[model samples]
Target chain A: MQIIIDPYSWLLGLAGGLLIGLSAALLLIGSGRIAGISGIAGNLLFERGPDRGWRALFVLGLILAPLIVGWLRPELRAAAPTVNAGMIVVAGLLVGFGTRLGSGCTSGHGICGISRLSPRSLLATATFMAAGFVTVYLIRHLPGLA
Target chain B: MKNLIGLLAGLLFGAGLTIGGMVQPQKVLGFLDLAGVWDPSLAFVMGGGLLVAFPAFALARRRDRPLFDLAFQIPTRNDIDKRLIVGAVLFGVGWGIAGYCPGPAIAALSALHPATLLFCVAMVAGMWLQRRLMR
Candidate 1:
């Protein structure tokens, strides 16, 4: 499939960031939750209360929205990338572990944390960006990986 | 009122993933491969995100309470401990290897991408394991 650069994509990207920021903001305003993926995911694991329903719903909406959009606009559907199952699993485990240790994921730290201008968040975001940079460098340059 | 805002926010976020071309793992992989044919598009996406978010955040901070509620709950801990560094490394490794971070991974699920499903399952498992270890 030929990849075409759609200028509309930029508008969508900007809109998406606004939505994420808005969601984080609203979650804080309404539910008093941080919309932090790790924290929300963690609550689903450790807590079995009524709050779980909203978290579940939020996640469900996240999963369902793309499908609904794709169904409406067939052009939106793109080929899935080729990656081994083992790699996928390892990657997931690593992210989960990182979230717990970091006390938040990208949404929490990069979005909500940074928004609030918390010193911890600043450190966390820097760490997050730096780590991403290193990983990309290693994967692309290292032999037998790319 | 809050739920409505949350829903709208989510819709926008979903649209952003679609438009940012972030839904495509290959695009992300390209950005990751700095030594090779690196695509600087993701940087633009990030920049665009910051462009929209930075001002909104600044404005929001000035308000004593959020539009619908009381004070913002900010995490107070500032210590750069072992957990912080190790977790970040792990996250980077995952992102580098899989080309999907948590937010985008969830977004990818809507596309019914197989790799995304596998990644999500593994992520959940990792979360469980961390809880166990922490306990």
Candidate 2:
């Protein structure tokens, strides 16, 4: 098995991760909220209350960040999708539904929850990660799938 | 004040994903494809995030309350229920298939890619579906 190592990508990922951590920290310090994208977005749609304002604004900021960055640094922007529309849709639905059912996603559970040393989050992260590894193995390595 | 902080946090989070290449489907897929030629960039992203967030959360434990709120609104649930396992597995399958999780998918909307738009729309619909099912 050959491993592909890219120092540039790793550095960029670390830098970006720092930014993500900083954002989470800021949200916690300032608003006493976890920076869980799934929770924020899901609640923004389903919940009706004073909480909507912050959720909406947070999503707006998320949407706007890439736009602003794309404008200024087009090369550094995210790439387009490689998968077909059908797969994207199906995956999106599953992610949305599953995250809500589980009460968290990578951000909520993997980042924030783990940081807080929550047992549930640790188990959830492990479960999802194992599931991901197995799923990818099936999709890519199985005889008929790939 | 809280709303403003939320916005800033979102912005930073999005930027992090984009800069880290986590917003790219291929990169995520590469990380997941452990049997194949594995890319370990995602690990660094998580590591870097945890390095900072761990300390911040520790500090938070010492504080009585946040700056803009009466109290911290952290989750306190600790049950290892069926829903958690089932939901995570399903989410993992979807993530493996499309290489887009909630955060990156939402941030990728700026690209205005048809697949991303469709994914986001479907994801919201899925969220709505879950709420309906729960009700």
Candidate 3:
């Protein structure tokens, strides 16, 4: 397997990952909650409780952080994806359904759950990551899929 | 104060995703497409998150409740069940297809891209459908 090597991106990835970890850590310490983005965002729609405000605020911050960055660092402005919009919407729907059914996503299970050594999250993370790998293979290799 | 912490967490998480380049579909797709021009950057990003989180969770186990809250909301179930696997499979396929999971998608909503907006709408609809039909 050919490894794509780029030191700059590696540095960014590690820094970003640490930040993500720290954010989860903060949430855990402050509210005793996992920073699974899907669960936090989904709750805004399906569940109603006094706890909704924090979740909403968390989501709002997630949505707006990039804008704030763009305002501060014009050079770090986000680049737009060029994929077909219809396909993206379908993917989004599937992701939404799957995450709700699965009970978490990358953040919840991948980072927090795995770090805490939760068995369910571990299984879920393995399954999803494998599925992701397989899906990418099929999408890229299969004649009709790509 | 609790909500403020929540907001800070969100802000930091979003910034991490941005800086980590998780917000870009191409970057994510590169990471997933192992057979293609594979990108291992995301692995580093996830690793970075885990590195800091490990000790924090260690600290978490010592506390019965959060500092600003009355109780902890950590998951307690240990069972690896069908729902978890099947749901994850579906979610993975979707993530592979779009390169935008829930977090980045939400973050990208700030960009006001039309298709992503459609995806978010559809995602919410799918979530609603799951609530109505899956239970």
Best by DockQ: 2
**Recovery fraction of native interface contacts for candidate 2:** 0.80
Q: Over the stretch A1-146, how does candidate 2's per-residue lDDT look in tens digits?
A: 46788999899889989999999999998888998888999989878998899899889889889887777777767765687888888899999988988888999999999999999999989988888888888989999999
Better candidate by TM-score, 1 or 2? 2
Instruction: For each candidate, give its TM-score against the true structure.
Output: 0.84, 0.97, 0.96
Give the per-residue lDDT digits (tens) of candidate 1, residues B26-133: 877776666667666666666565555556666665666676645665566877787877787788778777777776787777666677788888988888898889
DockQ, all candidates in order: 0.46, 0.83, 0.81
Q: Count clashes in each candidate, considering only residues at least 3 apart in sequence or on different chains.
A: 0, 0, 1
TM-score of chain A of each: 0.83, 0.94, 0.91
Q: Which candidate leads the pack in TM-score?
A: 2
Q: What tens-digit string does per-residue lDDT give for candidate 2 at B13-52?
A: 9889888888898889899999999999999889989988
Candidate closer to the true structure by DockQ (higher is better), 1 or 3: 3
Estimate, for each residue in A23-139, the C-alpha lDDT of model 3 and write its tens digit: 999999998889998898888888999879999999988988988876776655555456687777778888999999999999999999999999899899999899988988998
Give the clash count for model 3: 1
Computed on alpha carbons, the lDDT of every model, listed in order, comes to 0.69, 0.89, 0.88
Q: For residues A1-146, write the lDDT of model 1, one tens digit per residue.
A: 12435556546555656556656655665555566777776776778875666666666666566666667666654335467888889889998888887788777777777766767766776786677777877766668865
Docking class of 3: high
Q: Rank the candidates by TM-score, best first.
A: 2, 3, 1
